[model samples]
Target: MAGTNLQTPILQVDHLSMKFGGLVAIGDLSFTAPRGEITALIGPNGAGKTTVFNCITGFYKPTEGMITMTRASGEKFLLERMPDFQITAKAKVARTFQNIRLFSGMTVLENLLVAQHNALMRASGFTVLGLLGLGGYKDASRASIEKAVYWLEKADLMDRADDPAGDLSYGAQRRLEIARAMCTGPELLCLDEPAAGLNPKESLALNELLLGIRRDSGTSILLIEHDMAVVMEISDHVVVLEYGRKISDGSPASVRSDPKVIAAYLGVDDEEVGDVLVEVGDTSVIEELDGVAPVAQGPAETSSMFEGPIADTVEEAGGETIVPASPAASKAAQVEAETAAKSPVEPKGPAQ
Candidate 1:
């Protein structure tokens, strides 16, 4: 048998399992994130998405399996064996949180400089030589400041560098968080809901920033996002999870049309499969012709706007709140609705 190529996935999760007493947050999960690509892990609330993030980032050790990451310079790290700092220092995997976690009291530039603390410490040799002004700590500090400034420019936060982090707008704060993560010089960047709260312009800015990171830095990204436009526009690959298990994994197009994925997001049972197929097929065709392929394109892509009985069912059963549509999201939904109305539909037939 031909073995799967492992030249080294930027991040490889193999049979990873995590439990909190009786609750199995992640169960036998496995996947690979290719280098220089954006891979999105998305699921409804309480699908154990954040739990998996914590495990990979060293907030919790896995109950089983391996999490491996290969650096640009050919260094391979067993992420589970390393502490959080080693995960950052050795594996070079950096992350942002679901909620913005900036040093609210600190200046924007200061928040970024703190991320390079380890590098600065090492450059100082942890010795009195630095205290005696013999070491190059001063120069190292200057270099760190330069790196922070570079990222601030990339995030478009250079103008606000001297402002308190808390003083920036919601979207600015989100970008600042990403800049701070990049300051760590990670090979793999993990973002948990970077677009959780932002206007359309801000979200688009984020999309551009992420694309720039991929294009210029060759950095691979793993993100958990509920924003359909952001996910559809930027992600090269997508993974859908429900109830702590993998439901679908593929390109955005493939996963969107997956029946299992549709049902998972809609919280419908197998018995209602025919109805969903009928509805999705009808709406999708209409949406396609109306030039709103973005909405009719996939289930997970459009379910964010659903607030009917199906949405309620998902909330009750999945034990997670349905992420509400942001103002930008409503525009996307309006476009989808128009598409559904204008596109033609086909008669429903038995599942092929």
Candidate 2:
């Protein structure tokens, strides 16, 4: 196999679009994973992060666009045109899913060994030489074991090498999945939500493992992650998505401070949006955002925005009205009161 190109990006997704019937899952998405760096794809829920992964990994054929994987010798493979297995075998791409997909019944070491199946089969000449334990089969099997052991140590799974994969803890299972992908000797590794469901400690450990993979093995990683801690700490580049379109793409610090990125994640209520927009230097949008103010149409509309009996209070207080400092303040107070009323209170008694 030829070595990968260090100068060019390992993966280039250009104008990629995936649509299921009338629903567009990803639209005209484009990004690159540079060689020997960790690039993160981040977004709010239903942002088509995983859909992008599926398109890259060949799980879903994109509706329109090109996915090109370039290697060190300057060989370019059109990933969109290849079968999923070909993408892995010929293109040297490996990926782990958002959910762990391991042979649970198999021992930890066996799972890693399975990743080398194709190589071993060729070395065995379709298992004929292996059945007789002759030729290069012995050497290939030994090398496979050594490779598995190497990843086991890297993943901190040496202690559980003989244990069943299903018995490992959730975090351990996550590591094992990555380790298995690494055993395939991928030039480009695509990881979907690798840090999902991890504790602080586990997240930190995962960060280290990913950094080590780039530093030592020279594998370029493209990851989809919601954990900002993981994304900000290790990613060399970050691409953000919203409603199937690219919203922000830059360094972790830049993306973190971007107004669009912040607003997307905030999911802020109408009253709080102006403040957020102001803070993010989006003053132009503040007036537009605040312009959608609720009008007091009727008693139901008034009651929906405000809690308690305002008229009764005013009547009982000798017709004296307490006025807010400003329209924004008044709106803020109304939203706060309405939110408090809508929040679910904990039950004091046991179940019936």
Candidate 3:
């Protein structure tokens, strides 16, 4: 296979739209994800972010628009015309879900082996040639095992390859699921909320694995993440979505400081100011990010943001809520989320 074009886009969504039962989920959204880079798609819960992913990945036919995907081999596939299976098999696009989608009962190695089902089936000639004593099937099976082992090593789960996927820690399971997807040999990998519900340490591990995928495997990645820390830390490009429309697209630093992005997050919870530190270009604004102002609609319920295990309490100083990332890191996380809602949309911008 030819190498990916770093300067050229691997995926392009042109004026894409999706509607269901008279309600528009996405509206004339257009964006290009460059090859061999991490691109993040971020938005509030109902901003129709996942709808855009669905349209691009062929889970939805799309109400209108084109999803053009250029492969490493320089073949262009119109994804909108393809089914989900064809998109995965032919276009070489693979995706992981917000929720880890693995067969919990299956061993870690089995999950990856399952990802190679198409390849193995082909190798077996649909079992017809295999029954007729095909010679290559043995080599093909061995190759599949080698591929599975390679990904297991990459994920650092080689020690648990024989263990049930469910037996691994939450973070390990996340890596295992990603390894299964990588085993499919995708040119473009789409990850949906890969950091959801993960601890800070687990999030760090996930970031490293994703970075390895981009740097070593040379697979372009598209991500939908609410975790600003993860998004900014690894993404080469950022695309912001609001109500299914592209709001901002730029380098991480540029998007992090855009007033539009700040306001978009503010719209999520006007009173909650925990993320204001990222809302502006200056770090001096950190003092202003305290306490949640009561909104008439109440706090908007959204996906996990500034969230993790609730192991501590939000402290109070002089009747004012103090958001802590203090010595008690656990309490600080809670305070951060208390001041911000579940889906606090702000970019940390690759900074600690």
Candidate 4:
């Protein structure tokens, strides 16, 4: 992966916080996504990751914190102070939702052309010049169509250009939404769960498409996703959040190895997970168990998010911690005990 100059981040969230009367969706979280990199924000359900996205995109005003965005040309703007339209127009940031928000009744080409509405409207003097086909509206219209066609080809949807967006396959719709966003010519693209319902083939295609966008267009991507495969495979940097706060931020490998992160995924407190030395054999010797040996977490390993297993509190016999005879039994007993201890876990509050 290519690296960017570290002097300034393309988007910087500083001590950001959000409150909805009494619920704190985000609490004093901060992270910097460098320009030209795919920075993935991931966490368990209800981690307030999307709330952070909303704050950055000007959908919600932060109770406290500063969002500083630096344009490609070196102009810096306080994003929190800007309106949503300014964030899109001046800041050059684009976003796609988890739910496909395409114009279902419109043709695929029309949906993308609509993304360029602002530029066309300007060229048309807000319809007066466009209706008369006067001024530069004709030229602008041509350029807009050209841009839409360009993105359609890139997304492999040119053949569907005249097709209604709602009639396309689910995966095609996902690609179309992304292509529609790209027509706006954004510097920073924020995607929320682009791979949500994609099949393996569709997910792979998305990976290639995003990589092409970064390599060819130099657009920075900040994404919120639960798909670990997508997050770990495509992101240049990964930020992990827990309970509305950042628990780890680094390269995928570094964050994966961090014991705190291991604990987070394993549903154990960092303090309870001891470093373990594993020796697998017919009579394997496992030491440093402490009845809470931390499992070495790999990229995107936890499917259950907030729920995971803990080791059984076995006796340390002859200076060697004993694991249960049957691995399955151990997991069953451990999970049951852990659930009993942490039962009635409070639901993570609603996202704003």
Off by over 4 Å in 3: 1-6, 128-133, 266-352
Sort by lDDT, top down from the best:
2, 3, 4, 1
Candidate of highest TM-score: 2
lDDT of 1 by residue, 73-177 (tens): 766789999999889877889999987888999999999999998877777787555676667888988999999999999999999999999999999999999
lDDT of 3 by residue, 42-149 (tens): 988987888888887888899999999999887899999998999999999999888888999999999999999887888889998667768677888898999999
Clashing pairs in 2: 4-72, 5-71, 5-72
Model 4 segments more than 4 A misplaced? 1-7, 266-352
Off by over 4 Å in 2: 1-5, 266-271, 275-352
Report the error of model 1 at residue 74, Å: 2.3
lDDT of 4: 0.77
Residue range with the least summed lDDT across 10 consecutive positions in model 1: 306-315
Go through the candidates in order and give the clash count of each. Answer: 1, 3, 2, 0
> Best lDDT goes to which candidate?
2
Q: Please list the C-alpha lDDT of all candidates, in the order they appear.
A: 0.77, 0.80, 0.78, 0.77
